[model samples]
Target: MKTAEGLKDIIKPENLVYRKSSLITDKPFSYCPGCGHGTTHRIIAEVIEEENLAENTIGVCPVGCSVLMYDFLDLDIQQAAHGRAPAVATAIKRLMPEKFVFTYQGDGDLAAIGTSETIHACNRGENILIVFINNGIYGMTGGQMAPTTLEGMKSSTSPYGRDVKMMGNPLKMTELVAMLPGTCYVTRQSVHTPAAVRKAKKAIKKAVGYQKKGMGTCFIEIVSNCPSGWKMTPVESNKWMEENMFAYYKPGDLKVPAESDADAENKNEQ
Candidate 1:
């Protein structure tokens, strides 16, 4: 076996192809082991680092599992009241137009109580990124049913599964936002696998780049898994999400800017 010093030269910077983002904190994540939140955080940090926005980026997080993100990312973070992240992010971006602003929200907060805030911000065409995580149930509050919970999905509150007749249908928030004219880009993605993570990271980078061009609202819904809330092992939760969550919240771009508009603008300039 090679000694520690003998291995140091082999692990030189020239040979390094991968490493954790410097924007990420040394503090361990409060999220549970195997949770997707950790991966999501890592990818976001990587995007900011790659874009060289570590000093200029601002993140807004509200209550629930999403709130702890401030501790994990070294960038400037502003905490908002539960379900009010979008509104807070709107103010930040408007006040500091030079800063890259984004909101990190969960389904329970964005699709339910903050529905108005989320809608208004997107409708007003806030030039900021909105990162929504949909775990179906309220992960931070004892697995209660959320507005995005699948029809017939069982939760602590919906012990027998959700009933569309009484409980109402699960809200496709991403699909709803895609129809809004103020939004320039919208998509649903997951981070359970390496390929999916790569796609998600790319989507995030694109959203950030759009802000520089003053594009309208950019939204990305991460169909994440909550093993603790779902009462399943991490592996089991991922499998279930693939079969059920993706069926309804299918992963793909829901909306993107029209090429004709860009073409017309270029023609006008010429």
Candidate 2:
């Protein structure tokens, strides 16, 4: 009789000769089955391989569900204190201007505790990329209410449903970040479907490209699903994100800075 691993290999062809996955271990991930983190990990790995940036890129990981991302992403990684990834990335990018730097942060870490750090990073126009995952609830902490928790959503901390009067409205970080002068590009995308995933990959690649060109602060916000925290199956969570979450946080490019006024004037004179 064949082993389960053998059966899996037989069922799925491994003919595609892409770069080997950067994940180092065979241990199963600790994430709940079907969690969006796995998908995000694959996308990031593919992007790193396709862009040939594994050697020069560094990632600052936040203290949320993705805290253990260093174990998976083979590139150089630094773990940051809760909500401090942006600040850490800023320092690294400034010190090593030639290296590509990015921070992977969840909504709870970025929109809640790290709001000031994230905002200031964008305002300062740091030449770095930020991948923000907004899954609505605080997935790492037993489904607590987060700053991005939608109205009428029920979580362990908000069992009675989010009360706008008491809890305040959902914080739209992407929209807010777009308003800052330092931001060169900002877009909100989702990863719940094949087409959406492709679009998200494009957005991420664009953000990385902007940083490589010395453009300040490229941000991509991805609307993901937390199946375990949402008390639903993975399919159900995807449905919820599409039906409810998208209505509130419609995905699109929120900002793109034009050429510097000085550069444009110089070109015109020549």
Candidate 3:
């Protein structure tokens, strides 16, 4: 409870240990108090700096919660139409192959309207990183059931919970995208806990590194918590996600390098 001048001595330059990412500007985040967007943003920024890709990195975002993500990142961000980010990213990456291109999209944006775009781009082997945040509902556009909405999960539109027989099954886009021959690496991660945060960051770093190496497309799905949309407190949302979301989505590597690379590494070790 001290003024700026009063705390100077106690908070000396050496006393400062950790700081926010420089890529994060003074612009305040518009995400809800406990939304995962901020944490995901910070993780991406740190990896961009750690991998020395901040300057050359280009980000594409489309309609939905991810549309505003550009406000938090300091890199060059392109705004695409609803479900059109993959097309924009494909163009950007193809024209300037040297630049590190990535897209930040939500389940509503990627799995719902942009499913075709996402599939075609990945199938073409576009060397870009796709950061997909699946909270299972449309957070920005009311709490409607999204493509990833779990079975029996209630939403504004699905007031009685999603019924498999009536609404069809929740789309597992990550697993579907993983089977594409163009995809080089695929992982499902979460940022709800400290340990999970570390793993998400590592996954991001690897995805970016893979792009730099011209490895095919990389898709990272973050099964995040949406407290407001889920009608739960931030803490409750985290717990709910762990219990329900993780059970269905299940965080882990969905796909990785082929056996050829493993054999080559084994020979090198020998």
Instruction: Give the Cα lDDT of each candidate.
Output: 0.91, 0.87, 0.90
Model 3 collision count: 0
Order of models, best lDDT first: 1, 3, 2
Clashing pairs in 1: none
Count clashing residue pairs in model 2: 0
Best by TM-score: 1
Per-model TM-score, in order, reads: 0.93, 0.88, 0.92
Highest-scoring model, lDDT:
1
Residue-level lDDT tens digits of model 1 in 1-270: 569888888898899989999998899999876788889999999999998999999999998897988889999999999889989999999899999999999999999989999998999999999999999989988899999999999999999999999999999999998989899989899999999999999889878867888989999999999999999999999999999999999999898778875465446536
Model 3 lDDT per residue over 155-186, tens place? 99999999999999999999999999999989
Every model's Cα RMSD, please?
3.6, 5.6, 3.5
Per-residue error (Å), model 1, residue 142: 1.2
Estimate the lDDT of model 1.
0.91
Worst 10 residues of 3 by lDDT: 261-270
RMSD of 1: 3.6
Clash totals for all candidate models: 0, 0, 0
